[model samples]
Target: MRSVYMDHSATTPVKPEVVEAMLPYFTEIYGNASSVHAFGREARKGVMSARNTIAEYIGASVDELFFTAGGTESDNWAIRGVAHANKQKGNHIITTTIEHHAVLHVCEMLEKEGFEVTYLKTDADGLISLKDLEAAIQPSTILISIMAVNNEIGTIQPIEEIGQIAKKHGVLFHTDAVQALGKIELDVNKQNIDLMSFSAHKLYGPKGIGALYVRKGTRIKNLMDGGAQEKKRRPGTENVPGIIGFGKAVELAAEGFEENNARLIRLRDKMIAGIEATIPYIRLNGHRTKRHPGNVNFCFEFIEGESLLLSLDLVGIAASSGSACTSGSLDPSHVLMAIGLTHEIAHGSLRLSLGEFTTDEDVDYVIEQLKPIVERLRSYSPLYEKATGGTR
Candidate 1:
């Protein structure tokens, strides 16, 4: 039985070069980055080098980048930290209804802390209205938190426009770019992004390391209270090995970004075309062209997404319904709901995200396998019969 893994947006497999780069940090250079001794200096060198590589990749200054555990921590720090630090400026934040739970939950927490939050809704194509965003601003609006690319649907938000709006209002702009970093072109300077969140695991680096880009002079309260690591913004013993891996991963991802993205985009479109040609009553999700290179999401009417996932797993095909973090939840994806998908349609949604490792043959195999699976599942669903006028 051949296997194909297509859930790269959730996380990517560690590249061989990244693993090799990190091996030394685990044994030979194992020391706390905060120490002044020779051993500590070695580890610190690795951390600083990694920071430089990441900062340069995103076109940010070295001093503006800070390391974190992963996207969740970075999102929390960006939102809560900015809210707390700017209380004198305002007590309101703006975000979209289709954001990852990381941003949504943190905004909810801030709401409880006496900060007001306005969730802007998305259109059918999963794009937020710039006018709606502009309208959401107020005298109390201090920040706007949005995702660069949606984790579930792969829709690219108009961050540059949003950034312009935020700048016009004198409000800080932060974006969770964990899903967009390696897949798209992002420059903090060109985008006018004040702060951004990143995760290495989503780009073929280690899982336990991430980074946050903070523009110079951006006021942000410390999330942790310990040693003066990460410029006192985030404190703890740094993951030296993970940082090394992340650096190597960033280098490798940048080198092959164009070639890999083109290949993945071809595979993505082939799969979408194949599935649409074979599967009936299927609604394609996300913007057809403005989405990520590897994202192919769809709704198979009447069949449950969990059932499709399990059946695909049986055939050694890995995919997802939404973000891996919320996969276990029985509720339909908030992202799907935000995009105007009904509960029944959202429950039947499936997301297949390609990656560098994905191949032409893998796409063909999945399309062939998925058609029968959907048909078989729909055969058992009475709703399918009713919707199809009992054709099955």
Candidate 2:
């Protein structure tokens, strides 16, 4: 049996070109970016070039980009840094309930530190209303951190409109664009986004590397202390090879983004349509139209998600579920719950995120495999028996 990967939102395979671009840095130019020596100069050049490429992709200046470990670190830095630096102006921050743990956990930490955090609720479509955002703003609000695209549901938030609201209220706007960087075009200036977070791994680049876009003149305190690396914003020896790979990946993504998006959208829509048409009692999650092209989340009623996941895995199909077990307690995804999914519905949710490498055959394979797995799970479900009038 051939394996099919439908979990790009978790991480994607490193692109071949990106890997090639990083090869030279590891062996030929393995020097500390902080050193003034020739080897260091080569490494520094690679880092700067990568920064420039990333900046161009997001329509930000090279000086605005600061590399970090990944989206989590960047998110932590952006939220905490801004809160610390802007405390004189305000002590309150705003964010939605459906954000990734990176943002949500940071807000929770801030709450423990005497800062006020307002987690706005989203509608059934996993979108935070601009009206609700406007109503949530307080005089002491310092920042609003919303994601550009939801990682689990692929819901695209109204970032630009939120940016406008932030600006109008004299608050800084930050967005975790980790899932949106390559999937959608980003212009920090046009969107009035004061700070943005992106991870390389989400775009087929190497892991352990990401960047935060802090608009020039945005006063954000440093999360890390030490060397003046990343302009004293983030400290540590730079990952030169990873940065190079990231730059190559960004370049390729930008070059092929239009075509790749169209293809992935077609595949995702086909899969969603096929699954709904073939499977009974399935409900789609997220915005039907205003979602990421590669995301498809659905809930199959009357069956536990873990059982369905295991059944799919048996046939060489890799997928994910929102269910939580007792000990591990992964429970239903907060994202689904935020979007108003009942506990039962959330427990049965599955997220199938496609990528540039996903093919029509892959989608078809999943569709074909999913029906039987769901049927098998439903066969043992008491709810299914009741709904279908079958004898228990």
Candidate 3:
């Protein structure tokens, strides 16, 4: 059986080039960035270069970007940092129900602390309305935090428009661009994004290293306290190897940005088309076109997502039911629910994400394996028997 990996959204394999770039930091030139010695200065040079590379790629100044553990920390720091720093400005914030738990949980925690949050609803396609966003903004609203792309369904939010609306209201705009940094075009200035979060692993870099882009003059407080690394904003000895790997990954991602996306889009559409044409009673999730180039999600009727995943795994095809973080839970996806799917449909969802290592043959292999698996799983379902009257 051919092994196919379709879980790029969960995480990506560190590119060989990224690994190569990181190798030097482990053995040679290893020094804590906070140290004042010559070795420290050498290591600090590498860290600064990486910071510059990532910042430049995202159209940000070097001073505005700070390294963190990963996207989750960046999100927490962005939301809480801005919330606390600007509390006197307002106590209200706005986001969506479809956000990753990183953002949702943070917002929920803030609510418990007496902060008001307006969760703007999204349409069935998972796109939030600009009108709802505009209307939800109040004089007491301090921040508008939204994801640039939905992790589960791959819905690309109207960030530029949302940013404009936030600007009009004089509200600070932040985007959890964890799933978006390398996949889409992001310009902090052009998008009017006051803050953005990113993860290197999402872009084929090392895991456990990410960055937060805080536009100059954005009122945000530090979330951590320790050594004076990361401008004392995210103080800790930097992950030198991880940081270097992240920089290389971003550089590589930018090298063939358009071409890579075009290829992934072809693979994505082909998978979607193949599954839709072959599978019965399957509903495609997310915006048909306005989604991540590599994301293809669907809700298959009758069969549970976990069953489908296991069957696919037996065929050496790796996929996901939803966000990797919540995969262990029995509850259906909150994202699918937010998009108006019923409990039955939501429970049957699958997310197959394509990426750099994915190939045409891999996609073809999945299309070939998926139909039989779905059919076999449904054959055991009483609901399927009832719906099809034993015909399936």
Candidate 4:
């Protein structure tokens, strides 16, 4: 059977062009970006060029962009760095309950270190209420970290509004734009976003490379405490090849962003509609319209997500329940629960995130295979009978 990948949110296949762009850096141009030799200059130039490309994509200054390992590192640095640096000004951080663990765990660590954290609740549609955000703010609030688009449900948050609120409150705003970078327009100035995180692998670029955009004049302590790389904010030898690949990927994504987004939206809608039409007792997750174009999450009542994932894998379909980092855990997604899903319903949720390489045939194959598998699971489910008011 042919394999169909629908888990782009977890990570996407590296684009061929991105791979080609990175090839020379590994062999011919291999050199430490910090060295002063000719090869090092070439490598350093590549890193700077990539930084410029990424900054252009997000409408940030090249000087403000700092390269990191990936989204998790970027997020950790942005949240922890700012919180620690600005502890004199405040010790409170505000964020939503639905954010990726990168931000949440960092906040937890800060909480243990004497900082207060406020986790705002999301509506059933996975949207954070501005009113709740306003209410959560205190005089000691230093930063607000929210994801640009939810990784699990694909719900796009009101980032610009949140930014405005943060600015009005004189608190810094950071967004984990790992899932939003390639799919949406990001203008840091217009949105008033102080810091933003992005990962390359999510946008068809090489893994192990991402960037954090810290707006000019935003004071934040360094996460890694060595070398002057990334202007002393993040220390370590730069990943030259990965940065080049990321630049190429960003260029390609920007070139065909609208076209690819529209195509993915149509495919996502078709997949969602087809599944709902064929599968009984299925509930869609996240906002119906204000969501990422490539994301479709659904909860098929009476079946566990792990069982569904296994069944889909048997039919050569690849998807996920939630974040790839937390896949092994038996606990239901916190994101699902945050959006008002019961634990049972949360356990039944599956996320199918499309990408540029996804096709109509892939969607159809999933729809064709999914219905029978769900039916089989429900047949063996005693809870199905109880929920549906039927005798097994």
The most accurate candidate by lDDT is 3
Tens-digit lDDT track for model 2 on 82-136?
Answer: 9999999989999999888888988998999999999999999899989999999
Model 2 clash pairs are: 324-331
Cα-based TM-score, every candidate: 0.99, 0.97, 0.99, 0.98
Each candidate's root-mean-square deviation in Å? 0.9, 1.9, 0.7, 1.1
By TM-score, the better pick of 2 and 4 is: 4
Model 4 poorest ten-residue lDDT run: 383-392
* Residue pair clashes in candidate 3: none
Worst 10 residues of 2 by lDDT: 321-330
- Evaluation by lDDT, superior candidate among 2 and 4: 4
lDDT of 3 by residue, 1-392 (tens): 78999999999999999999999899997998768998888889999999999999989999999999999999999999999998988999999999999999999999998899999889999999998899898999999999999999999998999999999989999999999988899999899999999999999998999999999999999988887888889887889999999999999999989999999999999999998889889999999999999999999999899999999999898999999999999999999999899999999999999998899999999999999899999999899999998897
* RMSD value for candidate 1: 0.9
Candidate 1 Cα misplacement greater than 4 A, ranges = none
lDDT rank, highest first?
3, 1, 4, 2
RMSD, model 2, all Cα superposed?
1.9
Clashes of each: 0, 1, 0, 0
lDDT tens readout by residue for model 4, 71-146: 9999998998898899999899999899999999999999999999999998999999999998899999999998
lDDT of each: 0.93, 0.90, 0.94, 0.92
